[model samples]
Target: MNGCAAFCSPASTQPALPLTLAHPLAHHSCTMFFKILLLSAAAFSATTTAATTYKASFTQYGSTDTWGSGNCNVASTACGFYTSPGYSAAVSQNEFGVGPGAGAGPACGTCWKLTAQTDSSGNNLSNAGNSIVVQVTNLCPASGNPLCAQKGLTGTNQYGANLNFDLCIDSGASNALFGNSGVGLAVGSAVQVDCNQWSGEVVH
Candidate 1:
C-alpha cells in the first residue's frame, strides 16, 4: 500500500492510492517523523555537552620514589609516562571517589583536566591558569593506612583519601601546573578539578 493507503485499508476494490505531499494525513505523519528525529538529535547533543566537573586536591611524586610498586611495575598498568626528560608520570589516589577501586586495582587509565588551583585557604593560586591533563597510573597510600585517614578519607580500602592526584615531578611539564618543580603547591592544597575527557582504557 502507498503512504496514504497504508494508513487506511478500504474494503472496496480500489487501486492503491498514490501518496502525495499534499495529502493532509501523509503530511502530518511526515512532519511528526521529522519532529521526532530532530528531538532525538537534540537530546543526544545535550548529553554529549554535559561533562562532569568537581573540586579535588593534589600531591606530588617523583619517578624513583613513586614507581616500581603496586601496579606501577607493569608498564601497561603504570600511569602513562611522558617521554620528555623533565616530564614525570602521575598517579591517582583510589580515594578520589570517581572511579572504581578496592584498596588497589586498575582504574582503567581515566584522564582528567586540572583546570584551576586553590590554596588551603581557598585562595586561587597563581597557576590557576595552567591546566594539565593526566591519566591515572597507580593507586596511592596503600589500603587502610592511618595516613589515608589523616587526609580526610574515612573509608576502608583507601576509599576516603582527599588527595586527587600524585603529580609526577619527573614528568617535567606537569610540574609547572603545580609550580616550581612541583614545590609551589604544598601537599593538601585544594584545587578545582573537571572531568574533561576519558582516555586509555576507562572502566565503565
Candidate 2:
C-alpha cells in the first residue's frame, strides 16, 4: 500500500528490471556518424585554411561591348573571356601573379569565391554573408593602386585587407556580390577554387 510496496509483490520484494543491450547495428551507426562528423569538420577546416583573404571593391566594364575603351574592356580581358556572361574580377598584381605587359597572367581564368564582410565605411553590410564566384579576367595593377602592390611591401589596404579585388559591376553576379549600390568598395575574403566551380563560362 505504501509507494514502494505498491509496485512490489505482497511480500514486499522488488523485482529486477530487464536490461536491454544495444544492437551491433546501432554501434556501427554511431561509429559511422562520428566518422562522418570528423570528416566534415576536417573539410571545413581545410577550406577555411586554404582561402587567401583579400579586400574587395568594384569596377565597371561593358559585359558585351568588345570595342569599349578601358584596361578591362571585355574583348581585351587578360583571360579572353570577354564575351562570357558571368562574374569577373580584376585582381591586384601581387595576387594576379603576373609581370608587366603579360598578355595573359598566371592568375587569369582562375575562379574565386568572394564573400563580402563590410562596406567602404567599415560598417558590416547586410549582405555580408552572401558569396559569389568570379573568374579573373583582368589585373588591378600595383602601380595604379598601392593595395595591389607586391606582397611584403604592399601592406594592407585602407580597409586592412592584404589583397585587393576590383570586381566588375557589370558582371553577372554583381547584384549578388555587391548588392544594389554596386559602385563602392567592399571588404571581403577570397578563396581560389576550381574553375569548374564557377557557374558561368570560363574561357582561359
Candidate 1 lDDT over residue span 1-204, tens digit each: 654355443445855445552457655776677688789999998987675453445555554544443322234434332323222234344343332233334442445566445654456666555566665555554444332333333322122324455565554434556674333433332232333432232322
Q: Runs in model 1 with CA error above 4 Å?
A: 1-22, 64-106, 142-163, 180-204
Q: Please report the candidate that would top lDDT against the real structure.
A: 2
- Indicate which candidate wins on TM-score: 2
Clash pairs, candidate 1, are 79-137, 86-172, 87-170, 87-171, 87-172, 88-170, 88-171, 88-172, 153-160
Assess every candidate by TM-score: 0.56, 0.63
RMSD of candidate 1 to true structure, Å: 7.1
Error of 2 at 1 (Å): 73
